[model samples]
Target chain A: MQHKMLYVLTISFFKSFYRNRVAFFFLLIFPLIFVGVFGIAFQFSDPLNSPIDIGIINNDEGVSNGVVILDPFQGKIVSAIRFSDRFISIIGNATYPNNTTKLFNVQEYNSSNLELAKSDLENRRILALVVIPNDFSIGFLAALRNIFADDPLLQNITKNWEGYPEPTFSTKIFIQGDQTLQQFSIASTALRQITEEFFSLGSSKVKGVTISTESELTTQGLTVFDYIFPGLVIFGILQTLSAITTLAMTDVESGLLRRIKITQASGSTYVASMILSQLILSLLQLPIMFLTGVMFGFPLSSRLWYGFVIAVILMFGITGIGFILAGIAKNSEAAIGLANIISVPMAFLAGSFFIVPNPELKWTAKLLGGNTIRVLDFLPATPAVRLMRTILLGQQSIKNSWFDLTLLSTLSGIYLIAGLMTYSKRHFQSQ
Target chain B: MHKIYSNGIHAVKGLSLEVEQGEVFGLLGPNGAGKTTTMNMMIGLLKPTKGKITIFGKSIMNNGKEIKQKIGVAPQEFSFYSHLTVYENAKLFATLYDVKNCERRIDELFNLFELDEIRHQRSDQLSGGQKRRLNLTLALLHDPDLLILDEPAAGMDPQSRAVLWSSVKSLVRSENKTIVLATHLMEVADKLSDRIVIIDHGKDLVIDAPEELKRKFGHGETIQIHVKGDLASDEFSLIKAKVKEIWPDVKNSNHSLQIHTDDAIDDLSKLLELLKQHDLKQKIADISLRSETLEDVFIKLTGRKLRE
Candidate 1:
């Protein structure tokens, strides 16, 4: 009833939270770590459009006697080799395996360590590993004959020529298995260019690229962690508020709150104070998480202030939820458990940990509105995210997202009422 | 008159008791007695679980807040906020009680309890006796007309308890504060209560003045004596027979015999005269004669010790 009491409770809210160092770190640090690890795991860099910095390792020897070996595919070997890259190093050092020979390096050994070598290739560590065979001229010529026509004798001779100088022998023509675009395409084009230099192969021999033209998905490369940073912080604040509310239940049971009840401080005033405390907590939580992102170079979109407005609304909404939970919870443990049950799911579903499902869960979002517990629709948080994102990123407006915004606002109102009702419904019994 | 109608199970069983503007009434009971339940009913916490509780001829259920405001309750349990300083704790309750100038009252209580030095100390941090006293102080801070205290001094040490007893005596005797006290301590009830109500197993065992309960055990005395003169073997027997005619419960020894009687002093005077007539000089080692007290009356009425 009194505005002054609300202000006082709001101040106390931060005092209790900050006094607990473990709680402080758990609320702030835990979510940042959650985001960081997830961000790293979900990272995917687009090379052409984005900075796709890759490390390369080349272990290739130059071609022997200028002969290009057939690529190691059986019947499709000719085409596979035709499409398959023969390196002229696009990325690696220009130093060849044999100074006298101009062709790019190839693997001479058929060892098992090549798996590690291939792993490095996919991660873009090695652009290509080219191990040239000792009898490379002989092996290259015989392989080319077999690719020219599938002659059994030429294949047999090619197999024999692929062997080591004396008694050792194994498979040939190994390229990196898990290749990145840069590592892969560079190797293929380089091989094709080298072949052209040796055989006067037309541009036709160079296979055309299969570039896709679908509606391109160009994100700023926001990872799961980055997206969920604000979310986890919000979740933490809500959970802590709920936990505190539960603790306050003792005040009722122990007669302290009952005594308070007999005072001029009405139930409405008491409930409002608690709500104010929680909202302040959630608000404080927001800035902490936002700072984390900002420090980590995850810019709060320039429209962050609008996002801030949504955050305040969310804080109020969640504070209401916390009060409701606190009112219903029989004890501290129950309060904590119930709060987690609400917050954890909301965090995950609201895309605190990932992208909130899009176009919203159309029918459900319409039916449930913001009041729905189904965070998947992001009823409240979805529009909230959009609002925050647009603000942080300095977007024009939340034009088409009217439904989301409406649902969020409506859900907030509903929760606020429910929370107040829940708080007022329970009476303090004392002797 | 305080009207209390307890319905379900009838722990108090529709009991109605009253006192004048300023009177101390004691509720006496052993452990597991219905004193607490009765108190709860009076406070309107249990909703009677059945009956009606009235103070000043108004139903507590209807005038609960008004009645609650005028009454200060100190529960049997130590119910102060352990986390709060004594001053803060009192201030908190004062605020809750809607008392303006709560700081003055808190200061007053702290000084009254002699807790001014450590008013800032948490209640749980206090010694058991100090906590007991503070608990009383909190209730008194509101200056309520009706003070209902239950097991108030259960955990207090003797000195602190004496201090508390004196304060209570002053509150009732000097300040004319009406107090309804529930206690297991017979001595405390005897010293402070103008009238006592004893309950057992959810029933009122007895309700009367402490002297009345004591008188129920009725005029009886047993005196012990040590002989200085060696009386002949039959000499002691003659005196024993004389004392036994009046006392059905009698015990004897070579030098003494204890007799239960209506008048111990008269019986003692006759025996001493008989000693002189028989030419024997006897030593009167001890003679104690007094009205029966609460301890004897409680044991006699309940057929068990009061402490139990």
Candidate 2:
């Protein structure tokens, strides 16, 4: 009999919510707008497609050995060349494998305008500044002789060389930028690779070492949108807090709550009906948000069910907080206001937008068998968000997220019990 | 039962009354007279500060859940979900009460209240009269034994009020349900209630049948005379002195005078003779006699009008 009543109540609640136009706007349209706007914004600024701007200062004076040499590969006579100029030319003409997009927007700078280049770097006009020293050719020739000395065949080919200075003067090529900037790191790494390849061509004996990266997840390249998609979905789920809070407060202020109190329906049945209705809403929200995210270039995860599990667990906690707000508020307007005050900060603290720094407050919990607990772990959203990112972006299975799932489930249970107790004490108890 | 709020408001003082089964009991009071507070206490919505209230010979405080199941409340405000349609609202309550054959019960209520045509319309869009009818309809959906209606006819037009009163009467007559109605309207209490408790400042001043109380505290009958022309201050004072000789409670305002009397025929003859001797009959526009009503009884007990 109680189960039948719960079912009827849940259906009634759903009908009441969807029939109101304002509720439709908040439940569906509002979150879709967030996805649409953020999706477009992130796609344009994606680092994988956009080129980094860099400035090159080539100051190398050519080392004129006054000797002509035969190129082994081309079988043509060659004259001494400034390696610095060659390196700068290679960097200025570098293009991505797509052949249409350039790897870097290289801006040329002279010795006299070095300060100007540095100023441009500070203002983010350029990500990095490459300064080729005057002794660049000397450094290249000396390094080539050292490599040939290691290989006897290369030493035989360069033994007849004349008018070349001894391999003793070694110089450094400086790459300068703000270390804090991410673009600066990419720019420096690309420049270093180009420099190494240029020298490898000078001496046939020079060999280069390469490192490769592989992921256990999908082979598809992950973008910023993919990484933050779970957070966005979690944000949509958080909006249910306002809706549930407003619904509960409206019942109280309208005296419908008191009216229901006089009915045969137990308080737990009513509360369960409300939670079940909102849980259905949360379940529906996850798929809509996820599909919307996929349309906007978010990577589709095979482990989508993992995200659903996280949403259901997190909603239990959110619904509990909603009831708490309803208990504190005197009316629907105040309930909405309180919901915003709690949910907005909770979204940020849970890293719904960006990764938050771990809190400094840590203590050993004797109750948990001496396990260290951070202040953030107490918030259900913290674990829910982390678990979602792990599943959706990292493409890990549910087995890898047991700790986060357990923490989320425990916190959600605590909140659900707390919410029920507070609502009962506030609304059901006589004055 | 008594109720004192947490904020130290003595909302309901030592007020007590008994509601017999299958009878319409009325709680009549002026504004802020603790009618709602008293009704809330009876339904276990509030805990009385110092009193005991029982329903069906069981303590309401201790057996709240069991007692509450047998009672239905229609609060002063429109308490149901406004977003739901009339039929849906009825169905919701019926289901909550675990009514057998809820569909048939809901249909019966909708038909009884003439709500069949607008059953699909959202409650918030309902007219004031329609909303009041729907409020009463939802209360009767489960066929509760005791129905508590707080200002059920408040803000309704005369036609809608008559429809509600008839329906309420039918519930007691045909359904054998007890009703506890709280209202400040004296006519509603006089017409519908079998017994009424007139309370003021959280205390009951009188408790009896409406006619019995009127006979006990009423001023019998009143004769009103409307003058055609404005009289001089001296003429008015002379008429007042002449009327006051027989009935000292005569009241006059705006060229009109009212005289309270137990013997209307005798007083009417004396009043006419006094007017004729003074040659004031030519100035008399109209004269009428009316019996004292529950409003008069309430005023006699509280020294204030029911609305005040």
Quote each prediction's TM-score: 0.61, 0.77
Tens-place lDDT per residue, model 2, B1-308, is 78889888898888978899988999999989999999988998888899899998999999987887788888888878898899888888888888899888888888888899999999999999999989888788778899999998889999999998888788788889999999999989989999999999999988999989988998788999987676677877777787787778788988889988889899899999988887878777899998888888988887899887
Displacement of residue A363 (Cα, Å) in model 1 is 5.4
**DockQ of all models, two decimals each:** 0.14, 0.59
i-RMS for every candidate:
4.4, 1.1
Cα lDDT of model 1 by residue, B82-194, tens digit:
65667766765676566778788788777777888988786768999888888888787777888889888897887888898888887777667889998878888888888
Worst 10 residues of 1 chain B by lDDT: B1-10
Q: Over 4 Å off in model 2, which ranges?
A: A48-220, A365-372, A395-397, B227-242, B253-255, B281-285
How well is each residue in A1-431 modelled by candidate 1, as lDDT tens digits? 35554454344445545555676666656656655554455434221222222222233332433223354324332311222223223322332233422223333224446576655544445445544333333333333443334457654644643531222212133333212122233344344344333322232322211212111112234433444445554454445544555545655666655445544446676676666665665566666666666665465555456566677777667766766776788776787788777777666565554443333233564565543333344335545654454334332255534555676787778877987787667654432
Clashes of each: 24, 0
lDDT of 2: 0.79
lDDT of 2 by residue, A69-168 (tens): 3333344446767767667777877765555667788899888998999888766788788887777776666656555546665555555445444655
